[model samples]
Target: MQQGSVDAFGAPVSADTLKRYSGGAITVNSTQAITGTVSNDSASQVVTGNNAITGDAFSSASGLPSVIQNSGNNVLIQNGVIVNVEMKP
Candidate 1:
């Protein structure tokens, strides 16, 4: 909370991995039907899906830019997939 306030949803989440940490980096097994989204930037995103997670690698999203925005690289993830991404100038 930049406004000197504390909120659950408003708080920032620290995530390391994309697929294994979509849900705030949960230590889930390989066969637990995992899915996650990773944003490479503000205009592009990488959408990944692993519905089975049965010791198998799922699809990873790439270049999910809807509009040209952001001056530099901005990453955003939603639903186990990158919704938006932007390259650095």
Candidate 2:
């Protein structure tokens, strides 16, 4: 809904998922399955997922995690730095 909002998902994202990073960055270092659109656009996203998954909206040359386990995906990555993102499935 806004920037720098922290959320906790016990399941998958089945809606219009949009996240904004305003402070520093959002570190996604989980071992769960994120099935939705993931974006940040104002800061950086440190994706270090061993078993984390996405749903859709991901791009390869968009400075995103090319090795995402799932499909869901963004933000306007600056200088290869991810900021806000919008992910959905």
Q: Which candidate is the best by lDDT?
A: 2
What TM-score does model 2 achieve against the real structure? 0.13
The whole-model C-alpha lDDT of candidate 1 against the native structure comes to: 0.41
Q: How far is candidate 2 from the true structure (C-alpha RMSD, Å)?
A: 21.2
What is residue 50's positional error in candidate 2, in angstroms? 32
Model 2, span 1-89: residue lDDT tens: 43444466345433345223233345655353435544554434656435554565463346444442432234322233335453434
For every candidate in turn, the CA RMSD to the true structure comes to: 21.0, 21.2
If candidate 1 were superposed on the true structure by all CA atoms, what would the RMSD be? 21.0
Give Cα-based local distance difference scores for all models.
Answer: 0.41, 0.42
Model 1 bad stretches (over 4 Å): 1-52, 59-82
Q: Mark the regions of model 2 whose C-alpha exceeds 4 Å error after superposition.
A: 1-21, 33-89
